[model samples]
Target: MNKWLTIVLCIGLPLAVGGVSAYVTVQNIQNWYPGLAKPFFNPPNTVFGPVWTALYILMGVSFYLLLREPSSEKKKQAILLFFIQLVLNFWWSILFFRFHWIGIAFIDIVLLWLFIILMIRQFYRVSGKAANLQWPYLAWVSFANVLNAAIWYLNH
Candidate 1:
């Protein structure tokens, strides 16, 4: 693949998936979401859009770094972990915002967090920069897990 094409895919794929989740998310944000009991730690609603967009871009960049690795075996494992986490990330929005399944969303986020940690470890073996890029994602998802748990507990 050409370098530009690789970069585009690296960044575009995650953003596209995020865009899908956001489509489902916006539908409920005003109606279903506002009605739920939220945790005290919940950031203002405005914060989520920009933050998540940034995270997705970071995820894509990390994947690009992993993809650029010379070892196909290492790339394969990291790519697999990356996609697993990305799918989990996508489903959290759907499960929580679209279906209003708070408990399931919490579980999904936890799994996503774990996958991200594993991806970081795998990526570290391929590219330290890729591993480092995932740290903020790990941190954010860790925070999101706590937030998801608190919301589930509070609203249940």
Candidate 2:
């Protein structure tokens, strides 16, 4: 595959996932979300879109860097971990916003966090830069876990 095309696809994948998740998220922000009990630390709604966009870009870059590494068993494991976390990331939006399953969302986010950590560890083994790129993603998910927990506690 062409290197540039590979880069585009690497970046595009996470952005696409984020786009779909955002679609589900946006649909609820107006009607269903505002009614929820939120923590004092819950960020303004406007913060999410840009933050998520940035994070997805970072994730894509990370994936790209990982892919650039020589083929190896560790790289395959890292790639698998990345996809697992990405799937978890997508489902969190659906669980939280679409289904109004706050508790389930919390569980999903926790699992997402775990997957991210594992992904980062595996990414580090393959490419340090790739793992480094995941830091913001890990940070955001950490905050999200707190936020999800707080929201669940407040509402339930």
Q: Whose lDDT is greatest here?
A: 2
lDDT digits (tens) for residues 1-156 of candidate 2: 999999899999999998988886787978999999999999999999899999999999999999999999999999999999999999999999999999999999999999999999999999999999999999999999999999999999
| TM-scores for every predicted model | 0.97, 0.98
Clashes counted in candidate 1 amount to 0
Candidate 1 lDDT, tens digit per residue, 56-123?
89988888888878977877898899989999999999999999999999989999999999999999
Q: Pairing residues by index, what is the TM-score of model 1?
A: 0.97
Best candidate per TM-score, number?
Answer: 2
| Clash counts for the predictions, in order | 0, 0
The total number of steric clashes, by the backbone 3 Å criterion, in model 2 comes to 0
